[model samples]
Target: MISCVFLATCFVAIVADAHEAHEPVVVVDSDAMRQAVLAWRSTLGPELTRQASFEFAGPVRTDWHFVPKDRLGVNWHDMNLEQRRAAHNLLRIALSSQGYFKALAIMSLDEDLRRLEASRPNAQNVRDPERYWFALFGDPSSDEPWGWRIEGHHLSLNFSSVTGQVVSVTPAFFGTNPAELRDGPRAGLRVLGTEEDLARDLITSCTPAQLKTAMIAETAPGDVIALPGVEINFGEPEGLSAEEMTDAQQALLRNLLDEIIGNFNAELRERALDELEDAGFDKLHFAWAGSVEVGKGHYFRIHGPTLVIEYDNTQNNANHAHLVWHSPDNNFGADYLQRHYAESPHHQSAK
Candidate 1:
C-alpha cells in the first residue's frame, strides 16, 4: 500500500470557490499581462468585448476545460488581423517564448487532426486551428481583480491578476493527440518532446527499490486522473518521496520540474522555484504507472505541497500526451484575491 504520511500539508480544500480561491500568487515581473489584455480587448470593440468579457466573481471564471467544443468568447476565426496580432501579444506576455511557440504548435495540430481524421464524420467541422477562444473576467484596467483564459482543443490557460500582480496561472494544460507526427509536413515533430523525454529519463533511472516504491500501478490510465471541469483531489501523497532518491536522481527530478515550470516567463519561473524551496522540496513525491518504454502507455505525477503536475501518455497507443501544472493553495489566484478583497479600500468602501 502507498503511504499517506508524506507531506504534513497536502490536502485539497473544497471551498465555495475552492479551485480558484486559494491558488498561490506567483508574481509576474511587470504589468505586461494587464497591458496586453487591454490591448487585445481594444481590438475586440463593443460587441466582441461584450461576448468575451464577464464579471470577475461570475461562475464563468472558474469554468475551465481543454476539450474541442463550443466555447464562450471570441475565437481566432472571428478576429481581424489586428485582433489576432493583439491576441498573440497577450499570449506572449503570459508565456515564455518556448511556451508561446508550443501553444502555437498545439493549435497547428488541430489542422493535422482535421486531415488525419478527414474520413471521420464531423472531423472537418470539429478541427480547426482558429477554434481557440479568449475570454476576460472583469475590466483589465479596473482597480479590482481580473482574469483571462485562452482555451481550445488540447490547450487551456487560466490566468488571474490582483492589483497589477499576476496572482494565478494554474490549470495550465497542454496536450497533443498525435504526440509524434508521422507523415505531416512537420513529420516526426514532437511539440512536447522535452516533457516526455525528461519524465522517461527520471522513471528509467530509478533504482530497484526506488522503482518499486515509485511504480504505483502496472497499468496506465487512458487519461489524466485530474480531468477538466472538476475540483482536483489526488487524495494522499502516494509515491516515492524525494528523501529516497540519491543526489543524481534528485537533480534529474529538479530538471524535470524546471522544464515544466520554466514554460512561464523568467520572474514566474523564479517565484515557482522559491515556492518549492519554501515548501519542503524533499517532501515531494514521484509516482509512475505502467511501462516506461517508449511507445507504451505510461503516466507519472509530481506532487508537492505547493504544486501538482500530472502527465499521461496512454491514449492512441501512447501517441497522445497530456500535461498539466496546478497549484494546490492557489489555482485561480484564490489566495491573492482573498487578501485583495479583504484589504482593498475600494472593496471595503463598497461593502
Candidate 2:
C-alpha cells in the first residue's frame, strides 16, 4: 500500500488567492511543475541534460508509447539518488496522489512479470521497475509553451503547459500485464481494477435491449482500437449513449468517468470534467466487447466528440490490460499551442 503520509509530504498543497475569506483556493500548481523540472534538469547536469532535453516542436515531443523499447530521455536506472528525488518531485507536482501511486504500482508490476516469466532468458532484462524514462521538451522556465513526459512499459503520462498553466493532459495511458496477480505476496492485486470493475458494473447493469445495443462485438480485440501514432477517428461512437441510459446508469457512468479523470491533479480534473459537460454528456457513448465477466477477454470504450477513453483486457487469457485517455484536438496541447503561437509571433519562430 502507498503511504498517505508520504504523499502528503511530497505534494504539499499550494494555495492560490481566495475569492472570499472562508474559501481559500488550492490547486496543483503548474509553476511548481516548472520549478521542479528546472531543478531536475539542473540535477541532471550537462551530459544527461543533452539526452533528456528536446525541441518542443519536433516529432520527438509526440513520439510516445507505452511499450518497452529504446525510449527518449533519461531512464530511472541512470539517475542518482538526488536526481531521482527531483524527478519524483516533478511527478508529484504534475499528478494527483491517486495518479502518482498508480504509476508506482504499475511500475512495480514489472517485478511480477519478471518472476512469472522467469523461464524466458530476457525476462529479467526487460522487466524492470527502473526502466521508466523522464524527458522535457523546451524550457519549462520560459514564457513559451513546453511539455514533459514520463513513460515506460505499461505507463505513459504526457503534460503540456502554456504560460505557467497546464493546458493539456492527454494521451495518458496506463496498462498492466497479469492484470490480477494470482499468487505470491501481492496476490489478487489489480492495479487497474477500478477501471475494469466500473465498466463491468455499467455493462452488467444494462437491460437485454441495452446490452444488444452496447455490445459491439462477440469477441474482444487483441488490444485497444486507438494505438499510439494512429489517427484517432471513430467517426461516430458505436454504443449506448448516456441519453439512452437510466438515471441510475448515468450516475454509474459518471462515477467511472470520475475514476478516470481523478487520475490527474484537481485543476486538470475539473478542467476535463467541464470539457466533458460542454461536449454534451448526453452524447457520450459506452461500448463494450466480449464477455462481461471477471478473468475473461473484454474491452470497452467511452467516446464522444471531444474525448476518448478506452480499456482492454484480452491478452494472456485476459490478464493483460490497457487504459487510455485522449482528446482529438487538444492532445499535447495542439489546439492550445496553435492559438498561443498565432497570438505570439515570437513563439511561432521558436517552434
TM-score, cand. 2: 0.91
List where candidate 1 sits over 4 angstroms from the true fold: 1-28, 345-351
- For all candidates in order, the CA lDDT equals 0.82, 0.85
Estimate, for each residue in 1-351, the C-alpha lDDT of model 2 and write its tens digit.
Answer: 233223332332321122224563259654777788899999998989999989888898898899977698999887888998888888867777667777877888888788999998898889877788998988887887888999999899998887678889889999988799899877887878988998999999999999999999999999998899999889989999999999999999999999899888778899999989998999999999999988899999999878899999999999999999999899999888888888886787443
Each candidate's TM vs. the true structure?
0.89, 0.91
Could you tell me the C-alpha RMSD of candidate 2 in Å?
A: 5.0
Any idea what lDDT model 1 has?
Answer: 0.82
* Candidate 1: tens digits of C-alpha lDDT, residues 208-294: 978889999999988887787657788887788888888888888899998888778777778788989899889899999999899
